[model samples]
Target chain A: MIMKKTLKFAFQKSLPVLFGYLFLGSAFGIMLQQEGYNFVWALFCSIFIYAGSGQFLLVSLLSGGATLYVTALMTLLINSRHIFYGLSFLDKFKKMRQMYPYMIFSLTDETYSVLCSCSAIGGIDENKALFFIALFDHLYWIAGSVLGSLMGQYLPFDFAGIEFSMTALFVVIFVEQWKSFKSHIPAVVGLVSATVFLLLLGANNFILPSLIVTVTVLMLCKNKVMEKVGGET
Target chain B: MAIDYKTAIAIIAVAAVCTFATRLFPFALFSKSETIPKSVQYLGKVLPPAVIATLVIYCLKDVNLSQFPSGIAELISIALVVGVHAWKKNTLLSIGLGTACYMILIRTVFA
Candidate 1:
């Protein structure tokens, strides 16, 4: 009974991720296959690398013959933002005990959102719900990737713009976060800094510099930004 | 287009390890401390929105405005996504419709 209840709640919580990951994961698989990697490679990357955007970026990096150090640096820069996610969940995760490492390992941006909004239901175990949500999401991603790789081997039509699903996913999340927040300074800072740096440094190299500038600016304005934004978040 | 199997595996391992380390860093550092520092708390609140906004920009980094077609398909599709989502507030519909629109535009018109 408890297992059934936890599974149901986890399904409900992870429904949003279901759509996003399947499509985006398939997109990654297709992209990888287009670069001549087989389905096994796609499965391995999704299962292990597991970072959505980083895995997408990884395809290009590998095909370009980037060294391991370079690949690691790029992955770090791309996923550095995850560090902030761990901070928010510090207290909640500490209670997880044995489940803590798995929770941290699977805390992608989408999972973080679902976990953040997870509330205790009358009959469901919160930790079990969190665990199941994480597990189901990871599986969906793997399923999508493997399916995409298999389809890529036989699809006759071009999927030229299919990757845009990723962009669309991020936009939806951005809008949702926008609605949730009272103050818009942090959002603006991120948008402007990234846009400016993208134009200055061009697409290939702007991310690191943009992240540095955004973090620096946010830190400098920490007092006022936090005061205005308050503790509502 | 193919990387050596050994090289490919090495790169994947590196990417996985690096990504995991970042996620694990905060818990490792602050899990024992009773109180997270004030600055860290403020950042925990504000960084998500900015990071997400930055991701949006990252996704669009390749849409060139100076070339022929000039990102028209991308612009129209993105606008459709934003419009449909703002109006209907449906995530799957917005993404599905927007992606289908882009696929058609690129294949039929831009082809």
Candidate 2:
């Protein structure tokens, strides 16, 4: 009974992801197919890689015939932001026991955002919900890629700007988080740091530096920030 | 396109391993201790909002403000999302409407 309830709640929480992943994943699939690979390659990459941006970059690397060393380096640089995500989930996931490793492995940007905002409701198992959320997202990605690779050229509709759903999802989460917290300092720090770096270094090279600056600023003012958050919660 | 099968597989494997390595790095460093450091705990608490904000900016990084559309489509759509979400507090409705607004803007007004 608890398992069923958990699955239902997880499904509800993952609805936004279902749309975002399906669209982005299918876009990845169509791109891969146009590069001469087929659905099998799409399935393999989605299952193994699972990083939305990283996988898109992978398709390009494959076509460009990038060396293994360059592929490794590029993947690390592109996905380096993930290092910060695990910091927030360390203790929460540690309690998940058997699900710990998988939880860590599946912590994509979307999953991280959802999990960060997902609060525990009464009578529901948190760990199971987390596990299912991860599983559902992974499945949606796989299904979308396979579907797109098989029918990409035949799709009648134009998905030109459907990718904005991802941006909108982020906006929704940001608003939710904003309302939940008493302090907006962290959000401001993140905004200022990212915008500065994005202008300084182009889009392709801003994430890492921005993250470093944000972390450093937060660490430096930890006492003040904690006072506000700690008093509220 | 000119790459061989063996090379392609190697590239995929390397990318997968490297991606996993980034996700695993934080855990490997901090999980060994029975008690996480106070500083690390502090970051764990405050980083989520900051990170989410950064991600929002990251998603919009490619929109060129100097161009013809000049990010008007993104600006208008995001304003609508924030306004409607603040008013309705409905997640699905906000995202659905926001995306639809962007799609229509790009295809019709900005096309």
Candidate 3:
């Protein structure tokens, strides 16, 4: 029963991201192959920096002769929001003894959705449940990356705009989240903060400021969220 | 054909260290039997949407708005994306359709 519930959650929750990862990961794989990297590099990237956007940025920085410190700092900046990803998962993964590390490592946005929605799944162990979802999504990316690298050996076609698949996927998630909620405070806060920050701080620094402002605003609105919590959870 | 072992090792080390550093935080910082601070939890609820907005605008950051046709192409594409998802409620369909439309719009209309 537990096994059945977790599988259903994994499939239902991660389907769109699986679609997104297949194309984007494959594209990244093919690029690495073309850059004279063997399958090992692609494999390692999937295993390690499983982040889609962060990995792409890292590749560019690496090839451009950016120093290690600079690459690390840029990666930290680009993925600083992940610190929040960690903070949120604190309670969720608290009891998973052996699988805790992997859970933390693979906790991307899509993975979080799959885990968060798993309360719908009856009989699943939180430990194994979230672990498998993370593992499955990571495998999707790995398989896609490997396929792209091997396909690169013979392909003469363009993979140009396919890179935008991540952006498109995010738009899809945005719409889904918008549809699911009556309160638009988070959505509005996100847009206004990101836009304002983009204008004030420049493109590179926008995410950090937007994140800080969004958190601040949400904290101020906590009383309202608590009311919702009292009503729902 | 030959590959440079030194370069491979360097890349591997860099990638490994970086990956480890990222995983170290949530695993280390938060697992001590307490809820995350209320403020952080609230922020997580709000942050993902904002990140999406940044990504959307970032795509347009390089465009020369003076090339009004290109700007029009981007705006239409963005609207088409939002509309497709709203109507069908399927992410794969929305993203795939949006990309196909944007590809054509950029190559032909903006060209």
TM-score (chain B only), all candidates = 0.79, 0.96, 0.72
Least accurate stretch of 10 residues (summed lDDT) in model 2 chain A? A224-233
Give the per-residue lDDT digits (tens) of candidate 3, residues B1-108.
033546544654675566556656765765564656656666555555545554556555555645567467666766788998888876668777887777787678
As for candidate 2, its clashing pairs are none
lDDT for position A226 in model 1: 69
- Local distance difference test, each candidate: 0.83, 0.92, 0.67
Candidate 3: where are CA atoms >4 Å away?
A1-5, A64-66, A113-129, A224-233, B1-4, B33-35, B44-71
> How would the docking of model 3 be graded?
acceptable
Each model's chain A TM-score: 0.77, 0.97, 0.84
lDDT of 1 by residue, B4-104 (tens): 88998999999999999989988999877898888777777787788778877888888887887878888888888888888898777887898899889
Poorest 10 consecutive residues by lDDT, candidate 3 chain A: A224-233
> Predicted chain A of model 1: TM-score relative to the true chain A?
0.77
- The per-residue C-alpha lDDT of model 3 at residue A21 equals 75
Tens digits of per-residue lDDT for model 1, A1-233: 98899889899778767866876888889899898888899999999889988998899998898998899898998888687678777877778899999999998978876665456798888888898999999999999898888886575766568777767766777777787787788989999999999999998788778877988999988777867787743
Clashing residue pairs for model 1: none
Model 3 residue A50 CA deviation in Å: 2.0
Candidate DockQ values, in order, are 0.58, 0.81, 0.41
Provide backbone clash counts, one per model.
Answer: 0, 0, 0
For model 2 chain B, the run of ten residues with the poorest summed lDDT? B1-10
